[model samples]
Target: MYEDFASTLAATMWTDFDETPEREGPTAEITDIDSFVIDGNFPWTIITLETDQGVTGIGEAYPSPGVHEIVTDYLRPVLVGENPLDVERLYNLMRESLSGRGSQWGVGTIAISGVEIALWDAAGKILDQPIYQLLGGKTRDEVRVYADCHAGEAMVSSAEEGQEETTYEPEAYARAARLAVEDGFDAVKFDLDVPSGRDIDTLSRHFDPPEIEHKRSVVEAVTEEVGDDAEVAVDLHWNFSPETAERLCEAIEPYDLAWVEDPLPPENTDAMRELKRSTNVTLLTGENRYGRHGFRDLIEEQAVDFLAPDVPKTGGIAETKKIADMAEAYYQALIPHNIGSPVATVATAHVGATVPNFVALEYHAREVPWWDDLVARDDPLIQNGRLTVPDGPGLGIELDWDVVDEHRKTRS
Candidate 1:
């Protein structure tokens, strides 16, 4: 299917290029590409693409190791000297050039995703338009966001020493949900894979009866605490077997969760389909998946209720829009999984605004106090748990290089 789509798209591009007249002056070309790793709740890999025309665009890769290296060492070669305005062409170029590597998935796609976002940003600025306008047009002025509340209190990264671990008590979950609701989020999510009191074998991926009851207690407490104030979702982090996932889904069916995310591992579509059939809970998983091809089976089989592709990890702006288009055909909602800085968040918003089936974008940095500080905008990017799609050129936000430098992680 993708091959046919690519062939059609290539033919269209060739026709468009053939009809175009030759330009007189110098064209905007990519001059250099650089990447940085910032130490936040996670190590965020940020990329910057500079054009010969003096327009520089910024982007963020999903938090992961070696993303910066992949960007500088691999993707940079294909991107430099190319026209950043030809975003789709350049994106395909990057992928095809790295076919021998892991470009189809993993850190390879992650690095390319960041550079691809930077290309769009640069292209938007070069064309004096917002990314949504470039894609098609806006479906709405604002994009809804869901707060990723994690567990009790704010979670401290494991890199931070001498910090107390998050509590897993049901009351703690309730308190966290209440806090998110009071902070003006209409929707919230928490981790359901936290440690339960009883565990016979952690590696077995099977939940004992007592463990199931404990998870149920947490879900019940959170729902009861929030009541009608907010909708809730839970993330299992792909830590359970299909049988355990079915049991967990059945136990929480009465709580009216918005969705159960990544209940089982992402690779097994057959198992995911079976689990979805056996339960009434809404299922959403795609953050681990990459690009439109990565989500083909999940959408075609109707394995889950929602598609949650992480923009930076999946395939950046243009690629995610393609993924969303595919989901729309199947009547699925696009709730992007976001864990990067404001760069990726706003980029995802641009795509969200253009897609009709966009439900909401995830805001995973509520715990990162300086998250908003990373952007150089006068107003906060997120207000009342929603993002107003930027009308300014490109991604509609600028980076505070000073803040970026402060948070940058130094490698030995």
Candidate 2:
């Protein structure tokens, strides 16, 4: 068991900065990305787990400011000397061990998530096989993917570098969707919300009309181009109320949409179920969900037609698999929500490939050019819109330490 293997899990904080700018494709031109990322300071605190038998696993927590102290001060002690293989035991122990109530949903989940992921990585390393192979020996070889071509432009300079030129109009969006299909992707997801708001932080945003109109127009354009052959998804970023979402769904119902993602806030299953009951369009939610327990209410109640959980935020591999299984029991499709680094994408691909009931994975269509450089691999694992799982043990691909070191932000 992971609990008994003393050397199985160990954690260290690793930060990698973007050598290039991470762009927004069709979303808002909010100032938050600038306020936080102007200095090329994309700080992600990653944890590494090593086993007594000389195997290692890598996992990431929710990247945030001050993440180093949070990991070192709080999570490291709980994991430093524990067995990496005893995954379930450690998960339960850490759940009780963390401070404060409802810690499992916020930073607390993030802390334990890193530990759990590292353990999974270590287990794969120990078994000398890829992570998916260890997880019931991959049911499918390739994981289907959808291009999130919503990447507008890399924030290489400042947001004030003569203000961004709006190139991603409705025509441009449709063209991009076509190009994604040309490149072998069978599906694509585009955000139909205008990049409005002055203070567009992660959780808060002020509504604007021009932005919404622009977003709706963009969606209309993409729908015109892609037609029905491809699986097209639209993400609302939890901006609308149920009524607004319903109206939007009715407006776009003519497009034969594959799904409407995160139409309303994720926590409100009743609202989602209500919307689902009303809309002929497929309703989707669950990007902000945590664990299996967290998803149980949504699943049992039949909140939405699709379940999209992020890998890193939802307690890593094992917990995400469980969530998928639960979704399967309910006959809900599993479309993972991923919008981060390559490691997170690969981890998500593992789960998606092995699981029986899967829809598709999200990738920053515009971000590939920017994010591909971060990894050491030559060609990306993606081929023809399907990511071929790596053959090596653990997560398979290794981060370019030199590249990471060069772009590493000093914790000052």
Each model's Cα RMSD: 5.3, 10.9
**Which candidate leads in TM-score?**
1
Give the per-residue lDDT of model 1 (tens digit) for 1-412. 4334433443444443323234763368888898888888778888999999899988888877887666666666556677787787777767765676778999889988999899989988998899999999999999999999876445333113454444788877777777778778899999999887664786889988899999999999989999999999999999999989999899999999999999998899989999989999999999999999999999999999999999999988988999989998999998889887888899999999999999999998877879999998778888998899999999988899899889988876
Runs in model 1 deviating more than 4 A are: 1-26, 152-166
Count of backbone collisions in candidate 2: 13
Please, what is the TM-score per model? 0.91, 0.80
User: What overall lDDT, based on C-alpha atoms, would model 1 receive against the true structure?
Assistant: 0.85
114-207 in candidate 2: lDDT tens per residue? Answer: 6677666776676577888878878888788887765354321212345444555566567667777787877887766545333444344333
Candidate 2 lands at a TM-score of 0.80
Pick out the ten consecutive residues of candidate 2 with the lowest summed lDDT.
Answer: 29-38
lDDT of each: 0.85, 0.67
Worst 10 residues of 1 by lDDT: 12-21
